[model samples]
Target: MEQRHPEKRNDRNTDLTSDQNLKDRPERQESDKAEQDPGERNAIDSNPGERKPAEPNAGERGSRERNRGERQPTERTSGERQSVERASGERNPGERNPGERNPGERNSGNRQGNDRNQRDKDRNEGVADRHEPVDRVAPDRMAGEIAREGRRSADNGSSERQDRSAGERGPADRGTADRGTADRGTADRLVVGITLGDYNGIGPEVILKALQHNRMQRICTPVIYGSMRILNRYRNILNLKDWNLNGIQNISQASHKLTNVITCWNDQNHEIQPGKVTTEAGQAAFACLQRAVEDLKAGKLDALITAPINKQNIQSEEFTFPGHTEYLAHEFGVQDNLMFMVSETLRVGVVTGHIPLGRVRSSVTRERIVEKLNLMYQSLKLDFGIQKPKIALLGLNPHAGEEGLLGQEENEIIKPLIKDLREQGRLVYGPYPADGFFGTRSYRDFDGVLAMYHDQGLIPFKAIAFDEGVNFTAGLPIVRTSPDHGTAYDIAGKNQADETSMIQALYMACDVARRRKEHQDLEANALNPKQVVEK
Candidate 1:
């Protein structure tokens, strides 16, 4: 061979083209059929030390592969360019160099990331951001979705005045909310579940009286869960019972004559003789309460208003439950409960309810009193429709123990609880010797009282508002209102059982229902989206 200079070996093909071709090669068909092929290109570019062979069609190998490679970017669609930047780790078209970014593309990603971070910050702060975290949606928020803003602290004085506009505007805004809830009732009157207390008592009479009015029909479709036999007796006594009782067995089980109807469930025709006190009557009364509780649980009844029951009667037949208050609490699985008397002037809640005086000392703790006071306050506002109800807290000791000289309970127990309640914005005042406070008609000013003992609140309560007071179970899941009196056995047969307490109970039920209807409407709207289309 003629002597060739080393400089000539670096030809046009070996210089730029060879290095550039190194970027893409191999995967050639010439490599596969080695018998018929010579240029057997390898797919994997070997390390500099060793070059692997027969990598056919690898690394952009073609007649004009380099030209095609140069043309790839210009030929790519915008979406493909974006995808290449994403999947192939290619730089964005505008800035494919270090220490720089494509302004438009970079700005787009920056804006999205910033929006996501801002949404997260707003959620933690409870701000109403347009975009929210999926997990932080109120429905997905851990149970107990309390109002995040303007929360009423447990330590402020309640009488501290809010803006007059806030007070005035609440109802005006509520008008819209109430209109929302009315959708269900207007379509079909609200199904009101009424439970008769003691059939032998005045449970049957009150129902006949309360339902005879046309107003109840306009507001609710009243369903009484009791025996048809007793309802018949009530209708007969009122003469309108003879007129057109329009009474039925079940909601779906109505007769032709039972058209504008009184709804009765699971009708048992036990002979109901007025003034007759028997275990059968007791069992029937007990059954009625149980049935009403089941209906309330099943959501068939919008609200339940119970009549007076003889405590002795409900406690009979091994149902030996203390009374309706305890029995209903047990039935509905409610642990925290209190007996409240709701009247126009004042509300009274018994601390150690239905238990004897001896047990009062042990049961009436500062903690229990404080909790009861809080519940009472909330209940008065929510259930009784009281606005900023004032509360009078009584002392366990007579003359409030003359300041611990006579007894230590007033000083040791009541004072601390009152202070705690007062700190929580409750209008609570007393340890005022029970005698002087209630004796002077001072309770009249307050909306409610938390008596240290059951009899302490009830004695004065019943004495003044006997026939008018409505027995209420505060802090319960369901609505329960009844007459605060016992079955008047003395006047049971005389037709002289003054229906005053029963009437009060009916009115109380109506008032509570109306208010509940209003409040539920407010809460539902605040919780729902703007566009709600019912099916």
Candidate 2:
């Protein structure tokens, strides 16, 4: 051969294309074929020093034979481009000289190279391309689909693969989030019907403040049976302009997503002065309570959390009952309901609630005491999820009637009921002196406590759980709770009313509803021994 200059040889080496080299050495064709698959391509690319077998097409094989000592261009495949890039040690084919062939196969151009680099980083960090880009149109996200895919992944016995398949919103995370939302919406949703107790009192203020909590929306839907005008006035007075109230025609129309208000009375002439109790306010309160009660009875509401009503003002032919407790009893046709006050720490129920103290002695009959104890026991079991609750009874007289010396009620009625209940396998305890029973915190020893009258049980309960106490009405067909504190007319407009009690009442109402449903479900499925029980 004629002598070629050293510089010319170097230029030829630099200019020689991969196909030319392949043609010059036809034996190299088999190695290129083995790395055609994208997965195999990635494996080979991960370790560029490792070589894979390749197989050339018949045309290329023939071209290699024909051009024994010459060079020629030929059609390029993606595998060929990858092979050429690998052989040339060009890490990114996209950055190759523009004069090079098959520039599209490596990555695309400058922009695409950057994108591929980022994608490679993401892949290295365990973020694979399982999901489409957010800019792309995607199908709706269904809870069932997410759950099924998760189960399928888990069943495959590769937790890493399962997580990869699930991407960021994995089966467990998405399923929990979606199921939690759905359960809160369906099963745990307490559609609380809130009656605006004397509109002029702290009822509207406390209701507004309590419902304003973001967490309230997650647990229960609130339907305020009050006037929009009145709520707006209070909202403005309390500077709670940020809170939005959805006005609805009826309870059925209330929205679960927002605090709904069903207008019970919207007379512009009616005065709405905070800290003042008026007949109009009482009538409005009664109207709201009446409407809410109707809905509650009609099954539109899960629970009823009443605000306080003025005993003197809210009395007319429409509302002749003493208060919410007596009114609810008559409405439900229950002769008496247990006035159960509940907190996280303790539970207290009274034999005579909302009745005069003088009449309390007469109300402390053996039948009444037994009835209240039975109601309290049942409430502790069903409403509170206690299987066999221990109960303590308080004396009507000081020091438990001093062994019948101070009074005869405790010895005459209370102790006999306790004795009979205990003999019947009930976990009923003593008629301990009210002062000492609560004074020494002995009430904490038992699951529930029964008092002869209102103040007897409530005084200690409020003293301990004042801001958190919830007044629950037991023995009624429906669930009803109220804040332990009454309507504070003095602090109604001033915004001095603490929302803790109302919030607790709302929480208790939802919990009681859930417990009642759970108890009913257990009763219904009691025969099935193998059935899975929910905790």
TM-score of each: 0.60, 0.65
Q: Model 2, which residues run further than 4 Å from truth?
A: 1-188, 528-535
TM-score of candidate 1 relative to the true fold: 0.60
Model 1 Cα lDDT, one tens digit per residue, 1-535:
2443323422421333334434233532233343233433332233323444543233323312322323332254334445666675766443344334322345456545765564445434422212111111121221112212112211123212221222333454645544444454345344566776667776676566555422243334566777666776666665543223445555544221112344343445466667767766777677777777777788766667777676765666547777877777877898878889866666778788888878889998877887788789888898866788888877788787887778898888888877876898767888766678878988778888878777788888888888678888888877778877776655553455566666556555655666676788788877456566677
The positional error of residue 147 in candidate 1, measured at the CA in angstroms, is 31
C-alpha lDDT of all candidate models, in order: 0.60, 0.72
Query: Could you give candidate 2's per-residue lDDT for residues 1-535 as a string of tens digits?
Result: 2554434533433334343434434454444454357864455335434444464433333333332323334435334554766787775443455345434333335434564455445434422332221111112223233323423432324433333434545556655545544543454456889999988888888889877522255456789898999888887888876446788898777665568889887668886888887889988988998899889888989899999889889999877887889889999999867889888788999888877777877777888888888888888888777898999988889899899899988777878888888889999899899898888999779999988888888888998999889899999999999998887776778988998788778767777787777678778878775666768
Candidate 1 regions exceeding 4 Å error are 1-188, 213-215, 237-242, 252-269, 316-318, 527-535
